[model samples]
Target: MASGLDDVIAAETTLSDVDGANGILVIRGRSLDDLARTARYEDVLALLLGNFLGKETPLIQSELGVARAAVFTHLAAVDATILALTPIEALRALMARLADGEDKAVALQLIAAPAVFTAGLLRLRQGLQPVAPDAGLGHAADMLRMLTGETPNVAQVRALDTYLVTVSDHGLNASTFAARVVASTRAGLTSAVLAALGALKGPLHGGAPGPVLDMLDAIGEGDNAEAWLGAELAGGGRLMGFGHRIYRVRDPRADALKAALAELKLAGQTPGERLALAEATEVAALKLLRLKKPDRRLETNVEFYTALLLEALGLPREAFTCVFAAGRVGGWVAHAREQIDHGRLIRPQSRYIGPAAA
Candidate 1:
């Protein structure tokens, strides 16, 4: 058995594709670079949801946005339970609160899950009371407001959107697979999303970016990047943000997000030379890796820019995974709805090898 299920095809899908050799990610029919910059999160959801929900209606974006606002006010029910628990527990509790029904109104639960969960985690971790969402603001704007208790400037909002759209979906990765597995059990959408959240909280998934920032901090300023990376590699430490399971070339989302972060540079922003240092370090490491591990194809991935952009956005290290969830909710909803419409029970058989014939 491939314990990690490497190179395994577990399901037939009509979703995104990860073409590492060609360095392309096609979601639905559009390229990731095309959509991350142009399409709004709701627009992509509408595209992914497709015929799953028959006769598409208008105001989905507005509806989800408004629904997201409404859900924020109600997180108090779970706030007390999970504040003392781990983030995954908090996230699960939040998902339960949102998933209490199957009526069409449950669509609002899709919008509410990420915002409420992320905001609540931030507040609980910071020893502050969670603020309710502001209905007057857009979803992205409202999330920022809820997290910080203050409105962000326009550049910040755009940067957030860019990051969100970039990560919104990426084929059937680990969390997506976990989500599908939960959904296959005929679980409610909230349960599936919570499963995905638990899977994602692991360091091997979206949680890796938070430590990437820590690595940068440990490296201090630009002067130490190369030597620090070298010593870490010699000790067999995997550089946090550099490589990916897919995208053997370069992550398209990385380019889009890095551009967004560059555009949003604020006044007296201390000019984080981290990006430049990272680029140089990546190049040096890639050259060295090619010489060392000649058979393995290692390339830069989305976490590189994800760490940079979120850091630029003033998000704390602990909030990185939650922020990732906030961006990925659209993809989760779209995928769950698509599976319900076009897919069957996701039952996969495994050949058991341990203690055989016992």
Candidate 2:
């Protein structure tokens, strides 16, 4: 048996493909580069949902807005104690309060919950009132507004949109697989989404970006990047964002997010000094990784630039994974629907090694 199901192909999917060997990602027959550069998050959502849900972008956006508002009503009922939990925990609690259903509208609600709940939970933790969703605003824009209680600028919105689209779907990742497993039981969309969120809260799955920022902050100045990274490597500490489990080459998502960061810089929005520090740190990390592990191809992955871009967008480091969930919930919902229709219950067998089963 493959440990960690390495090289195991559990199910067939048409939603998204992660060609790790080639360092490419494709969603619904379109290359990730094309989609990230051109498509909005709603457009990608429509693509992933396909006919299971309606394909109209505007309809999805409107429905998501309504879903967000509906989810907000539950905040009043949440225990203030839960708000003191980690952001992901708070989000999971709020999501569990959403009623389950097996319908397109419910799927939309599941997709909408992460964005609303995450923003709400973060605001609540900051001792601020939760901002309601604006049905008129697009998903990315409104998420920013909800988080900060101020209107987001155009560049901020675009950066977030690109992030959401880039991470929307990525093969059968751990969280998406969790979502599919829950879906296969016919537990309903809300349950599947909650399962996905639970899985994503783990550091191995969706928790690396926050550490990436921590690494940068510790490094401090651009001139200090190489020496700081060298010391970290010498101490046998693993670099946070310079490697991936799937991609042998540089992660395609990294390239996409770095390009988004570039756009933010060009628009005069991203902090120049911070951007320079991050870019210098990335270069140093890549160089040191190459020198130290000559046998392995360790390169920058999505988490590297994800931390930078989100930092540029003014999101808190603690809220990083929540935003990741917000982007990935669409993929989770679509995969759940696909598993329900075309996949099985995902029961795997294990060898009896404990005292020969007594």
Candidate 3:
């Protein structure tokens, strides 16, 4: 048996492929670059769901908008104490109130729940009333409006759409795998999504982006990056946002988000100084990592620019993982459907080394 399932292929999928050696991510036969630059979040969602749902993009968009509105009603049932939890925790609690089913409509609602809950919980925590979903707005735009109670500019919408598309799906990652495991048992989509959210809550999985910003705040200036990073490395600190488990080179998603950050900066949507500081920090960290650990090719990963992009879009650090769930829930839904259709119960055996059975 392979410990940690290394070199193990558990399931076959046509959804997305992670070419780790090449640092390539392809979703539904399109490169991440193509999708991030060109497709809207709803477009990608439709692409991911089309095979199973057989619905057109317009209908999917319409249904998803309705679903977002429908999920907003659940906020009334959420305890105020739950709203006081961190954004992700509050989102998980809110999603737990959704009914479970296997129909296409149910799948749409499950996909919409995280976005609606994330925005609602963030606003509610700020003592701001949650904005209802506008069916006329695109998914990313509506999410921003719901969070901030004001319409977002075009640049903000595009940056968020890029983020949502870039993170929409990868291979069977930890959360997606958790989602698939629950799905394999024929649990409803809501249960599978809850499993995904729980897995994403863990630090190793979805928790790095917030700390990425923390690191930047500590550095505070472009010129201070090298010394600060060197000291942190000397003190045995693991650099947040600098490496990935799957990609031996720089993560492709990192490049996609970096481009989005650049666009935001050029459009004056983000702080230019912050962008420069982050860029300098990335360069310093990469150089130091190469000098300190020549054997490991630890380079910039998605979390670095995910922090910058989301910050530029005006989301708080506490809501980073929840926002990630908003993007990744699309992948979770697609993967769950794939698993339920062609997969089996994911049971594995454990090796026993204790004394003979009593």
Question: What lDDT would each prediction earn against the true structure?
Answer: 0.73, 0.90, 0.90
lDDT for each residue of candidate 1 in 143-224, tens digit (9 for 90 to 100): 7888888888877777787787788888888888887777766676777787788888888887888887788778876667
The superposed Cα distance between candidate 2 and the true structure at residue 311, in angstroms, equals: 1.0
TM-score of 2: 0.97
Using TM-score as the yardstick, the better of models 1 and 3 is 3
**Candidate 2: which stretches are off by over 4 Å?**
none
lDDT of 3: 0.90
Q: Please, what is the TM-score per model? A: 0.90, 0.97, 0.98
Off by over 4 Å in 3: none
Query: How big is the positional error of residue 150 in model 3, measured in Å on the Cα after superposition?
Result: 1.2
Clashing pairs in 2: none
Ranking by TM-score: 3, 2, 1
Per-residue alpha-carbon lDDT of model 3 for 1-358, expressed as tens digits? Answer: 7667876898899899999899999988899989988999888887888876654777777888899989889888766789768888888888888888777888888888888888888777778877889977788989999988889989899999999999999898999999999999998999999999999999999988999999999999999999999999999999999888789998999999999999998899998999999989999999999999999999899999999999989899989999999999999999999998889999977889889978
The predicted structure with the larger lDDT, 1 or 3, is 3
* Cα misplacement distance, residue 105 of candidate 2 (Å): 1.8
